[model samples]
Target: MKRLLLVALLLFKWMTYAQTNLIKNGGFEAELSYWRGNDIATISPYDKKTGKNGCTINQYVGEQWKGIDQIIPLPKNTIALELSGWVKSDGVEKGKNEWNTGKFDIEFLSSGEKGIQNESIAAVVGTTPWTFYQKRVYVPDGASKLRIMLALGQTNGTLFFDDIKAIPITQEQLNKFQEEENTKRMAAIEPSKESKVTLFTNGDFENGNTAWRGNASTSNTVTKEGKAALMIQSSTFDWNGIDQIADVPEKATTITISGWLKSEKIQQGKDTWNNGLLNVAFAGNDNQKTGDDQNISFVTGTTDWTFYTKTFPLPSGTKKYRIMVALGFATGTLYADAINVTFN
Candidate 1:
């Protein structure tokens, strides 16, 4: 019993420490002790997501990047890293360039890069209250260093960042995550009393596309429940679609997608791709698309509260999947609600 208790304590400590944030002054209460940057960045005491302070980045000139960065040495065998934090913006407008905005960027310094930095950026724009942002990427080959950058990129406005984190994920944690996902999926499928988890965020569109994004998509009152739903129009362009990227469990066997869709005035696409469907596109751990897309059933023409679902055997090498509502080339309006994705 004593030996079992020791092992249990050791396991608990390991699980707790595995997700410790690597950033030193991420909360900004330390006042920029470990971070480095230019005059555009400063510690703001008046507004913050947590604690006493937050990092603020502003660009009145809009001529250059106004932000800060911190370079951290990664631990040995860091499988993947998740960067996340809260962002609040005040009239943060971009320049003529599209990429200019509030950006939480990561650059992995790897020997295999040969000098070119591997960059992953999660950008925020316009005005918003306290909002959460996150990005997860696989560590590159021979990676030894990480450059965490937060900046207002050529945008004329004020932005505040707080409670940032750089979490190194291990294989053990990934296995546990996969196990939890399986539990949720099974709970949803079976008649058991286990509490089922809602796998997707804001799937019902009640938050008015808060968790969904696309050029041609907007939240409308025309919902199945008459509350709110995501409305997509093909007039934005051919292949106009809205999608959310979701992490796939490693070695996951199959995934099932389901949702209710409503369409009106959907026309023939240039390639007969015009329809309401789930396009499950696969991506590798490096977050690059593998060009393999499973286009589920099609809902063409006018429809009201039509249900669609499909189960696909996950393609090998998939570390993530993009769940998309696409109109292909068709011209019409589509409404989507209660989008769900479950794993098996």
Candidate 2:
């Protein structure tokens, strides 16, 4: 009996030691402690997928790049390491330009010198649900440090990261984890039917702002496909806009808003920051703003009517949404027509 008790205690100790997180504050529960970055990222208590907190990186308008990183010393003679985390994003752009997307990366370093840097293979664009990502890398000989980084490079959007971990693993275990992750990803990508419902009234402005409000009027000066469109003509230097409240169906995961827009001699003023900018945004049921405002297009000069669209994830428990269109800090005329909102 004594021998069996000793074996059990030994097993418990081994398990506890193995489960220790190698990265300090890996779950971000301590609010950026042991992490290095600018104010571009913050600890969000309510935006986490797991634990009590998560890190959020924001790439606001006119910003170039932003990132948060941590460096830790490598264990002696470590052969391989596995890194994993959960991430979600909104409006993250993707292109050949590395600067135009959101990325999570791991790099091995020799003291302060850079070695291998591996970025997440999955393309993070538009709105996404919480997803798991994992990567295993072989530690090169003489490597002294490992760096974990999350960045929003040139993309105008937001990224949330949580439940991060890094640990040493054997090659066999890494291979098995990779295969399992790939299989799960493939299953998730299988196409499934999604029900789409329109939730806006008088979206086409055919009824002449019957269900709309704000500094807006109906006119024939600019129309996309109908005889009338919502028009906002700025005679003086004050912002003008329009909005309508609509219900969102329960269990809806995605929302898409679109419209046709045109501008004539839109001018930017020194006092106005977002001058000549036309944009759309989705607000919560309480008439409170939610998420980032999506800019359809900005007009500094005369331009013909153009169609613009944006897709965002509908927040959970959101029973109602307020759609808004506004003209900021400029003079001239802005026309919008054929507005559409869809929930899926």
Candidate 3:
């Protein structure tokens, strides 16, 4: 009983430590002043020069060290190192080739590279309070030093940074992240239990339903006149009262997004778009709008009704997303059902 109690206490302490040990726990580690080109200080170092209001070592401009500027001691069985940070820009915003872009890059090396720096490019920071940002980086088996940089790009902007922590995540943490991701995906595609699908436009009937309209701009008025049965065909053009969002739960391992899609008639004409083959992309749109039928389109099948499904590993940082369905110059009909999201 005593041994059990002690073990439980140790586990509790470990959990507590993991929950609060993100980078930037104790403020800035060091500060660098571009005034003196060769001035270098320790991580989270003290700074006499301040920017904005009254800058201190904790809030100085130029490249600064986040957290304890201590080189992370390489672990024995470590696979990768994920570096993350947040920045608020405050510089003369300029365009490309303007020498005022708020550009910044994070560099990593086995040893602090004086010139040959391995840089990871990122967007420029603008006028905003310190916001949270993160990125997962894969480190080679034999890596040692890591450094983050902030410089003036074509859009130089005053940048403030905070909260930078680096720790080796265990396999357990990875699994938890995956599980959280799957949970978010499931949340996005929940069945509306009360999906009140109103008949907008039926090709079979001449003027029974109005043309597909509303938030999801759809048009189901075109039809092919048949002798016996009038064929109905229309794709769900847009989402109805749906927001473009991505969610992930805690402790997620593997995320699988699946749905039942059925379609009849394959547009196989010489003048068809992309040879009558529809495409479904994760993040792409020609009009640059969410759920646009023109982007991320899918193909239709000919013959009898058939179901199609696909599954893939979820990207580490990707949690939730919106879905878009589209139909091009095709004949016949199409229907989607049982759109389900699951985590295993």
Best candidate according to TM-score: 1
Off by over 4 Å in 1: 1-18, 111-121, 183-344
Report every candidate's CA lDDT: 0.69, 0.67, 0.36
lDDT of 3 by residue, 45-65 (tens): 222122322121122343333
Better of 2 and 3 by TM-score: 2
Candidate 2 lDDT, 91-159, residue by residue in tens: 776645855777778777888767755545334777898898765455666678888878886677889
Worst 10 residues of 1 by lDDT: 185-194
Task: Give the runs in model 2 whose Cα sits over 4 Å from its true position.
Answer: 1-18, 119-123, 170-344
Per-candidate TM-score against the hidden true structure: 0.50, 0.44, 0.36
Residues 170-281, model 1: lDDT tens digits: 6556445433432332233222122432235776777775655454445566777557888877642234566666666545789888888888877654234446666677
Name every residue pair that clashes in candidate 2: none
Candidate 2, residue 49: how far the Cα is off, in Å? 1.1
- Name the 10 consecutive residues with the lowest summed lDDT in model 3: 236-245
User: Total clashing residue pairs per candidate?
Assistant: 0, 0, 40
Ranking by TM-score: 1, 2, 3
Model 3 shows how many backbone clashes?
40
